[model samples]
Target: MSNAARQQSSRTGLLAGFVLAALFMLSLFVGVIDVPFHRALADAGALELLLISRLPRTLAALLAGSGLAIAGLIMQTLTRNSYVEPSTAGTAQSAELGVLLVTLLWPSANLFAKSIVATATALLGTSVFLMTAHRLPPTQPFLVPLFGIVYGGVIGAAVTFVAWQADLLQYLSVWTNGDFSGVLRGRYELLWIGAAMLVAAWMIADRLTIMALGRDASIGLGIDYARMLQLGLVIVSVISALSTVVVGMIPFVGLVVPNIVSRLMGDNLRGTLPVVAMSGAILVLGCDILGRLIRYPYEIPVGTVMGCVGGIIFLWLLFRRPAHA
Candidate 1:
């Protein structure tokens, strides 16, 4: 990159960092109960609330958003399609299925066990999508994500049917609806694993960028294509599962954030990955804060908020000029 471009990227990163930090502080204070920043340190109950609820919830949003966004970037890179993401590409639905099965069979299963099963199912589902997506004409990139949506819908239907039969629709709802209301300090630590996965992704960003060049090109360049594919699958699946297992399915963070970042920053994964992560954090965290204040004490789920926001953005992406994209 030229010095000017590097300077521009640095400034962008600094600006995004500032926005994210400001949003995090805003999130800490935006709830039904006013936990004044000044008194929070002095008041034991206020400090406890911040520690137990507000801080964890904010961090969970940050982790879930950034992780899923990175997962989306990886999926897009591996598939060479900008439209596919964990939620739209059957990965999140598969994770939800895994969580549902474990809940039914192993009622006493721990969060780790549930996440393990969910990750496995997500891996399988995403692999299936990749195979089928490859079969569709590469000339039509839109079909890949469309097929994934339908594919995910079928899996989601199966999950719903099973949940209905087992009289666990409520559990299904909890897993489907992404909210941080129930996130406490202990409940949300699973997401830190997703943070670790983010680090792993950054380390391999260049390999992933090469892998995006298609199998033949990557092979010619001495890349282990299959191994890299598997690694990417694991990263995507694990992040999807962790997010679902903890805060439910957050849509569009994965889909929209990556696309927006790509349009603005271009597809140098090494340069854009941090911005993607930070942008995702800001989007989801801001949405969560909005949900908290929109109805006051009666909060909307972040999933609902994202569905509205993400749907509009997805439409805009579809209709906008290819030149802009």
Candidate 2:
């Protein structure tokens, strides 16, 4: 809070931004086609690939990471739980269900309408998880995420059942794992909705901090805790649903990124918002680049890459804590 501290914070902020920007630029050039500056300058085809494919893929990764990271922060703050996130807490499953349901019923709805359904289902799903978490007695440290995973699996099974009956399993498979290969210029514009949610998250971070204090204190301080919680859930729904709808599922981003940020930067959401967003973007973008390079032209999905990496990290995080059961 002092001037020197503020200056130090600013410097750290700048350094993080510089790192993220550098990584982001590296991401734009690492895909199937290597767009060297000179080659792109000389060849219209290379230039077109840069503008259409490379640029959109890069933007999609960044937005998905940033949005999911902030959404993780919001979920953790609202629930007062470190383990809960869109993927584990049933939000992703709910959103996927919504997408599938819409696809089945309307069969011809536009992308935006399907996005609406996805967001709605995600909201319902996350609300159920929060309610369950509220009712259940807190026990072991590992139990919460375990419960979340099981809860999500049940919902996911329902989704799979519907997909199976209709013989749309392959279609459903796309949303379960995320990849940027299909993200062309026109197709990936929906990811901007997630970016917008991130901006809104920054604006409301203080209120979220206050609400996290506990329902009674937040109300005593004249903060509408319920409304804040609602807003937070809606933001989470939009980010998770939109990202899943646009880029499939990128797991553990909300869970892993926010915890890492909190460890490094403390629990002040307002102070750490940019760093959280940057870290999220960096993690996903970095993984996406790794996914592409691992097998060359046969690219693995970013969600699958994150799942493998994040699962290991999650196990380490679980056991690393002395109190975990």
Candidate 3:
């Protein structure tokens, strides 16, 4: 990394850390049942609320954000496309389909079973996307995820058809509309899978960086390109699945956070990974806090706010492409 890049990364890291801390504190104190920040430390009940409720929710946000950012980084690097992400590429949607299947086939499925099915389905969907993209000529790499969107829509329609036929539309709706309010003690434990994914991502960061140079180049360098791609797809699938299972479908965090970090800090995964993770954490937590504040006692889902802001940002990026190009 250049000295300037190092400095920028450090600055971003500090800012992200500060934002995460503030989010933690805010989540603990600010809720429908307001616990005064000053008094919460001393009051047992307030401390219990902080420890049991807000702390877990905050942790879930951090883990999910970081995990999804890492997933996006890997996908972009593997595909050599800035626009690609788990959400855009049908991984999350496939996961949702998996959840829907489990719920319909066996309504009493455990969280771990649901997550496993989701992960497997996500891996399959991502593999199909990669295979399809590989066969296409390299005219516009950005269009790959657009293909994924169509693919996702098709699979999503199938899911919807089955769901409607089974009269489980309400159950399916939960997976479509992301919500963090349901995160608490027993329920929020599912986010630990995201923590595991974060560790796995860091461990394989070097291999991913090498593979990002393209298949021919990576093979020339004696790296197993196919295996590397499979590993990366697995990571992306598992992380996206877990996040969707926990918080529902959060579309643009994977795309937007990693792209922002790559532009600011450059595209090396090792260097930008931490910044991407932190930025994602800050973004989600900030959005969640904003959602709470905007509606006051009646909180808005974090997913709703992200979708609104992300849509505007996506449009802005679309219009600004010519200038950047």
Q: Write the per-residue lDDT of candidate 2 for residues 262-286, one digit (tens) a residue.
A: 7655677778888889888988998
lDDT of 1: 0.91
> lDDT (CA) for every model shown?
0.91, 0.86, 0.83
lDDT (tens digit, per residue) of candidate 1 on 18-48: 9999999999998989998899999999999
Q: List, residue by residue over 1-325, the lDDT tens digit for candidate 3.
A: 6888778878878887887788777776778888886888899998898888888888888888888888988888888888888887888889999988888888899888999999999999889988987776679875787887888888888888989999989887677777788888788687787778778888877778888778888899888888888888888999999988878888788888887777667777777788888888887887788888897998888889888877777677666654344
TM-score for each model:
0.97, 0.94, 0.95
RMSD of 2: 2.3
Measured by TM-score, how close is model 2 to the native structure?
A: 0.94
Best by TM-score: 1
Q: Say which prediction, candidate 2 or candidate 3, comes out ahead on TM-score.
A: 3
Two-way lDDT contest, 2 vs 3, winner: 2
Which number leads on lDDT?
1
How badly does each model clash, as a count of residue pairs? 0, 0, 0
